[model samples]
Target: MSLRTTLRVKTPPGFRVDASALLPVRLAAMSVAEIERIVLPAGNDRCIVGDVFEVSRGEATPALEAPHAGATLVIENAAPWLDRVGARMTDGHLVVHGSTGDYSGFQMAGGVLRIEGDAGHFTACEMRGGRLTVTGHCGDFAAGALVGDMEGMTGGTLTIHGNVGARLADRMRRGLVLVGGNAGEFAASRLVAGTIGIAGQLGAHYAYGMRRGTLLLTQRPAQLPPTFTGGGRGFDVFWALLVRSLAGEIAPFSQWHAASLPTRYAGDLAVDGRGEILVVS
Candidate 1:
């Protein structure tokens, strides 16, 4: 059996709550009483966990070894006022059962963070390593740089089952981002190095200033930027390998046939100009 800790919100807070400190690995070592006493930032005021949530401990069905030693934490009845849900988490499994505010999974370095509902802006900003899955749509700047930060999402895997807002993966350095629905403007803008796959419609200025990286799209845009030029044949081997690797990921990537090659365009020539955009027909 695995140790499972649950934090159920008793009432929605009038002010935003910073829940970054309530990580799975840290809470697993504490008793219920200890957890309840933990202080969390609420707007400008501080509140103890017990004051805002009902804490409980239970045994969860056993599963294969987890990334963080099988420790699990569940945030029940999560709301949009809950910010920084799993900031800087290094290990363990954390699940948010509802919507979350901005900066969810900010700079997380390891383990798995799953959001059952929508996530606000800057989700997974500057993330280093780990896996973050959002079942619903995400607001702007998901997996992108934080304000003046030079890099975003250095490593890890981010999967969004629904639509994504603007500036997706902006300044991203390294990682894999897969979106199941449409994306807003400036997707992959200034991307340094990474792989982003979108299965739906793209907004204007997509791949605006990409330097080095790969952007995979299932739907052709209304207009391909003039800076990008068609890439001639010769990537059949790479295409085969890429399709094979994505076979296990979300559709339509998983459904792609390795034998077929996608339409390739290379540019953002305005910059280092090495990035590629592959449109699956």
Candidate 2:
């Protein structure tokens, strides 16, 4: 039996609240109304509680019920530009009720973050662990490798239930990205190691400069890039496990686009590239 707490924003200019930085912070212990009483620094000034939003409380068992379960915090009509909704979160769960700004879960270490609405750019950039599940669309570089650094998302899972913008998973070294909807161009460009599964139509320049990784698409195009060679149709158990594990994490993935067996292709032949591309044959 998990407790529930709803903390509403009660301020006007919402300049001093970043609930994310206080993550692993428990709200269930506090009364529903008390949760809203919490205060923060508002840009070199102080403000009254409950001026910007409201709070509600309920219970959460295994799944977040939006009411109960200290597991979730409903961001009821929070102001835009509220970044880092779950930055560096190590444990617990977070659910966003509406659209969130950029870097929603930057560098998250562990735990689960479900965004019920759209998210701005760099949603899960450089995340090391945990799962970031988005019910709606996502901005550019949804799970891209960190800027300047070579590795991005070393562990964890990213599932976008809706369309995703450009540069998806750019230069990522590890982890997995499953796009249930269409993905913009340059998907998996310069990827080193990991898996990117795109269910809908892929944009142009797929796997650009990819050195080593796996890109799985539903379409069975006649030709691949000249740099790749067909590895023949085969059954991969790893893919089966991948789908099974992700299906529960990303519910939309329950819909299968192709058979369990798929054709595998290796390489962009541009770098030390041993990456493989699996397409539904």
Candidate 2: which stretches are off by over 4 Å?
10-19, 22-50, 55-58, 65-71, 221-223, 233-235, 247-259
TM-scores for all predictions: 0.97, 0.82
How many backbone clashes are present in model 2? 14
- Location of the lowest summed lDDT over 10 successive residues in candidate 2: 65-74
Q: Residue 35 of model 1: what lDDT?
A: 99
lDDT of each: 0.92, 0.73
Model 1: residues with Cα > 4 Å off, grouped in runs: 63-68
Question: Superposing all C-alpha atoms, what RMSD in Å does each candidate have to the true structure?
Answer: 1.4, 3.7
What local lDDT score does residue 253 receive in model 2, on the 0 to 100 scale? 54
Candidate 1's error at 195, in angstroms?
Answer: 0.4
